[model samples]
Target: MHPQPESGTGTTAGLPATADGRTSSAPPSGPAPAGAPDDGRMTWYVYLAIVISTFGGLIFGYDTGVAGGAAGFVADDYGLSSFMEGVVVSTSLFGGMVGAMAGGPLGDRYGRRPVLLLSGLLFTAGALISAFAPGLAVLLAARVVLGAGVGAASVLVPVYIAELAPARIRGALVSGYQLLTTLGIVLAYGVNALFGAGQAWRWSLGLAAVPGLLLAGGVLLVPESPRWLVSRGRLEAARDLLRRVRGRHDVEAELHEIRAVHRQEARAGSGGWRELNASWVRPMVLVGVLVAFFANGCGINLVIYFAPQILQSAGMGSSSSLLATVGLGAVNVVFTVVGMALVDRVGRKPLLLAGAVGMTVTLGALAVVVSVPGLPGANWLSFACLSLYIVMYAVSPGLVAYVVISEIFPLHVRAKATGVATFVIFATNLVIGLTSLPMLDRLGTATTFCLFTAVCVLFVLFCLRMPETKGRTLEELEARFRAAADSRAHARVSRGV
Candidate 1:
């Protein structure tokens, strides 16, 4: 049996059984780090797990980039009109919205790991159905399946990584998911080029299954989130797992921090859906919701979903337009890597503000270039401006929004709240995917660009007041919201309002 602590806190007394239903009779060595690196940091287990989990992102990115390139081909093969083509493209995002809503409660009920496994199954099945789909309706259904998987992965992966990482390194590790997403986009662009327009849409889409299979299998090898364990009242297992994850036996402090926070939350009865809208939480909660909404509103998806069509309208040929997007995909990947490196050091708000300024300027310039009407070099100039916009975006909101949503919520409500935020992300994303092409056709590309620029201006204003969340533990960050809630309660009492 474990020795009793002299302190009366009872931090380790009468702990519950682990999820596996085993209680430790004696203190034992922690779970072995899966791929213990020579660096002795045991966090290779973390790095390994993050890479494996983010494998879901590869398929998510592939769908994001491939759908735009493949849409025209799918339209041609099935004789779909412009409106129908938008429907085909957007069906998956609609599925993703459904998955985003479901992921939170399912994660809270089952566990994050099971949610991931289910997402992978959805990804694989969706890709296979879309690849050999013989008709229009079948293809739309397949896209929806794939979208549900992407939606679930998007919501849970950040929470998974954030909960696993140390405060000092948490931002960078969470940014790793975005890094994989960019790489997946680049891979999709390359696959689109190799398959040839209208020739191999099946192959381009079918390839997503490989990553899905990898994600499903890979999750079996990783540990469950320790916070999840502790929340389940499995403190004994949580304590041992923390030791392995952090590469040290002296994990009592961190374990206590997690346990203490949950104790307070339990006493306050804050775990249910109602707490999500409590006045104290409304401010930070809105922060996440608005960030998710605007991150998509800046019109990044227009490029991801319709870059070739936009470039083709600007005067490029089909083959050339497809090739150009490969370049755009490459730029997205490079800058996302840079953004990941910087998030921990330069801070989240600064990057969001700086990126907002750059996005505004570049988007406005692109509008002017496209509207010049046969101006010399308009297509290349549009490409130049669009490339700059991607650079601004990749380093700022592209990655920051997900990181912030994952890090800034009470532990009890974290996954559920993130699910709500990511739902907005997919919803805004769906709006762009479904309407952007129609908007471009009717509103004129220049006018559409201006609308996005206006959104960017609003984004800049939001950033001016958004809180910074770098270098703080999840427990520490949640306290800020509680402190705000407490201050308001005090004010109400003073005035007797």
Candidate 2:
């Protein structure tokens, strides 16, 4: 019989099976099949690593969505003003800026595992502090700490999965992070509904600490990223890891390719923000920033952070609104899974286009419904449109943006460029969190959603310019962009002539 693996977790506790179909917990002692072909089935090792890493996304989803539900109770207890509410909501994004910037260097210098470990510790520290926070200031500080964890996790986890995975299933594997993020959001909503009514937002906030702790501990079981090892010139270590993960027949060949890529990158000069100003770099950066803006802009943050408040304004009780938000989270998770399943098959750009179209339709209908006064079941109609909006986003940009960040930039500059992109995302989110309520109060629901609808239109246009990066290797992608930049420079010189 095949060796029995450990219980609960899918991986075996002893040595993993050899490529020759033999099993052992002992390290490889022979020339392994490092370059051998795979069976093409999702390996147990790969899937488990993804499952564990996605917990980082869970923390992100929970922290972001939980605030919207819990903040209302916080406001009631402390009698917060619009400014104070915005401050409270925007704290995480502010910290996320630091985390996003920090993530790249940390991942590059320390490898994916250590940085992930740091993220988990930050998450635990942030969550515990927030749970017992006695004042608005304390809570905001705690949220900042937590945001750092989210920002780092957001960048690193997908990169980890992307680097470890083969091209055939990379899209789906990376998308696991997005799907889990949705689950985290949905679970947050459920937790809020279960605990928010009795002034139990503290419990809701504290609960996130559990997953953070688990992530911190669970990361030890996963392997260090081979690409990260290759970058550091640790060829022997990288080879060992690849052999174990991919099995023996493919190790030497994979290492040869990885080393060649690293040498090429080294010769290309170290990548920097200056590259982003180059012609091809300019368009890709624009694509990342605008996609991020629409992803968080367009009032999605407003809806998430203030959904319960909006429901209460529409005439539901606070508790009832919290429960309704839970329903919305459920829908969000389901559609996100659908999006994950489709990403590899459908490609990134098409899903984004579909999501943009869906956002346009749903948000437009929402504006109309919220505008009508006491028109039979207007509140329900508005709620339905809101749910629809989430459904569209969950399957499209919600998942796609993360994939783009994972695969778009060259490997050499990937960490830094993605950090910049993430900073833009959180910065835009901060603006949304700070101003969304005032926008809603001053502009009314109709005008507010109309603004989002306009953003959706812009998102559609911007997405059309995004390259289809599916099924492409990181080396191929980098070469394409570099060549494109070179061609543009030649054109400019010709024009000057």
TM-score of 2: 0.89
In candidate 1, which residue ranges exceed 4 Å CA deviation? 1-42
Clashing pairs for predicted structure model 1, backbone only = none
Local lDDT at 163 for model 1: 87
* lDDT of prediction 2: 0.79
Tens digits of per-residue lDDT for model 1, 1-497: 11222222423443433444454323323542343212224477788888888887787888888888788788888888877788877898999998998998788777789999999999999999999998888888999999999999888899998888878777878888888888889898999899874479999889988888998899999888988887776676777777778887667667766766776776666577887887767787899999898888999999888988888888988889889999999999999989989998999999999999999999999999888888888888888988999999999999998889999888888888998999998899888888888899999999999999999999999999999999888888888889988999999999999
TM-score, model 1 to reference? 0.92
Off by over 4 Å in 2: 1-41, 272-275, 278-282, 493-497
State residue 217's C-alpha deviation in candidate 1, in Å: 0.9
lDDT of 2 by residue, 335-377 (tens): 8889888998999999999999899999899888888888777
For model 2 the local lDDT of residue 239 reads 64
Which run of 10 residues does model 2 get worst, by summed lDDT? 1-10
The deviation in Å at residue 355 for candidate 1 is 0.7
